[model samples]
Target: LRINDPGIDLGVAAALYSSRLEQPLDSDAVYIGEVGLGGEVRPVSFVESRLKEAEKMGFKQAYLPSPNLPDSAQKKKIALLLSPV
Candidate 1:
């Protein structure tokens, strides 16, 4: 499920991981942090848009880093995973 492409972005990686996780990313939610060398989840750009897209797609949850989360989104119907970087 590796998105190893020249135009690879966090969204691509997240989509791949979500598909592997069997979450049906078309209407599911997922996020990729910085992606450390050790495979740790780090903070990524545009947290708000990611969450918003998930919600718009009818996804009831999300996986994201705690550091990059928005205060307003913390209380949404979505689930947030405070992953370690």
Candidate 2:
């Protein structure tokens, strides 16, 4: 099976967001990564810019691939879950 590289992240986010309506997802959290058809989370490029934008938007948490993570203090607040988010 093939995954639509560009749309995977948005598709995953939409699914996650819809599922969280009843449980309530963390409003300050952001998710940035590609969800493969095998359910694996893959890293994307331009991570710095993405994280910078998220931070600017007041997001206190982020779920991203390990390889895309930064060691900055701002990134310390991130939450990475390899499994379904």
Candidate 3:
């Protein structure tokens, strides 16, 4: 399979890697974003849709790029974890 998107899973991969493989990320959380080589997370496309899909799939939380965070946060049932710009 081919992953045309630069590296959308890098954020979560970095977190898992940084933990020295001793700890794991929250299984109930959804992480969305592209991580740069410098460990900074860049915004990805279709963030709102992604969050909505995740919420529908039983994910209660999401970590995404700050710029991609939706303004309707107060109305969403899931928790959106906005990254700092």
The number of the candidate with the highest lDDT is: 3
- Candidate 2 residues lying further than 4 Å off, grouped into runs, are 1-21, 71-85
Reference-based lDDT, residue 15, model 2: 59
lDDT of 1 by residue, 1-85 (tens): 7654322244567777778998866444454456666666567676666666667767655656668766654556445433322
TM-score of each: 0.52, 0.65, 0.72
What clash count goes with each model?
1, 0, 0
Give one digit per residue, the lDDT tens place, for model 2 in 1-23. 77655424844665576798856
Q: RMSD in Å for candidate 1, one decimal?
A: 5.7
Off by over 4 Å in 1: 1-28, 72-85
Which one wins by TM-score: 1 or 2? 2
How displaced is residue 4 in candidate 3, in Å?
1.8
Quote the positional error of residue 61 for candidate 2 in Å.
Answer: 0.8
Q: What lDDT would each prediction earn against the true structure?
A: 0.57, 0.64, 0.69
lDDT of candidate 1 at residue 32, scale 0 to 100:
47
Q: Which candidate tops TM-score?
A: 3
